[model samples]
Target: MANIFNIMDFLWAPWRSKYVADSSKSKREEKCIFCEFPEQNDDERNLIVYRSKYAYIILNRFPYNPSHVMIVPYRHISSVELLEDNEAQDIFRLIKITLAAIRKVYSPDGFNIGINIGRTAGAGIEAHVHVHIVPRWNGDANFMPVLSNTKVLPEDLETTYVKLKKAIEDIINNEDSLDH
Candidate 1:
């Protein structure tokens, strides 16, 4: 048998401490990744796949699954309940558009749409509330991704981004032609 342990890896683990905690200080220093889109010129950096009146759809950089994305309001609001009626409506509308776009591109079997309210509720950036749209597939469940530090992304991020971006743009351009 061969040894599978390494002490050198742990030596650099402490450097990641800043990202391992929930603090107002970190939030203040790092602008919300979701809120940086309007200023982001590169679609690759922004990962914006779709745009709506009051919100936009962006792929999750660290995704729970392939084609995972987040729908966020233009305004940075921490609580979902605080969203205006129009904003709330737009969120769902954007979600629908994003779902269809993903299905048309990736053809996932199902999806998981949700919003983690607070830090304790699994919100990485508790300063902003965004709805997560995670595509699901049968037999996609496996512990290796977690246990082995291996992620099975069938396609690269750039390829997914370009394909999704084009599909979403087509829907927006041919809005009347699109069915809901």
Candidate 2:
């Protein structure tokens, strides 16, 4: 008998499809997941690694690489220029911390931190402004992404979450210990 359903046949990502579709809804989708997630106070469930004054860090649900995270301003704004003084400061601070966390966890060779302003610019949630901190290793952008248009994350999101969460805890709890 032949294996009729091969792994290459499809990508099992219904949640991603739904999440993207939900982001496009006009009803605001229950006050925005970003706005609602922090209030929930469930770091593990929400995949939030750390929370600061005006911004927080959460692991990308559909990550391009391991330990890929986002620095999101609490207030929902699409444009980076509109970020408040405090939000901007906190977001930058968090980005620094995110880099450390990723280094402590994944130790990627490089990084790609950016923001996509609008839906046209590759923002899945264009209504919210968030900074992406994507870790990059040697040859990470390999055959799969280029040929199949699919990214193959070596580990699960939850595993990455746990690893990064520990790194965040180390940084936050022992701020003085880490190199400044």
List the candidates' TM-scores in order: 0.80, 0.80
Model 1 Cα lDDT, one tens digit per residue, 1-180: 855666544423332244446345658687776677766756577788766789888888767688888989989999999999999999987877788789889899999899989888877888888999999999887655545656677887788899888888877777675564
Tens digit of per-residue lDDT, candidate 2, span 1-180: 978899888755443565577567833654677888999999899999888989999998878788889999989887999998989988987887788888887788999999998888978778889999999999885666546656688999889888888888788887775555
Error of 1 at 107 (Å): 1.2
Worst 10-residue stretch by lDDT in candidate 1?
10-19
* C-alpha lDDT of residue 149 in model 2: 52
Ten-residue stretch with the least lDDT total in model 2: 11-20
After aligning candidate 2 to the native by TM-score, how far in Å is the CA of 39 from where it should be?
2.0
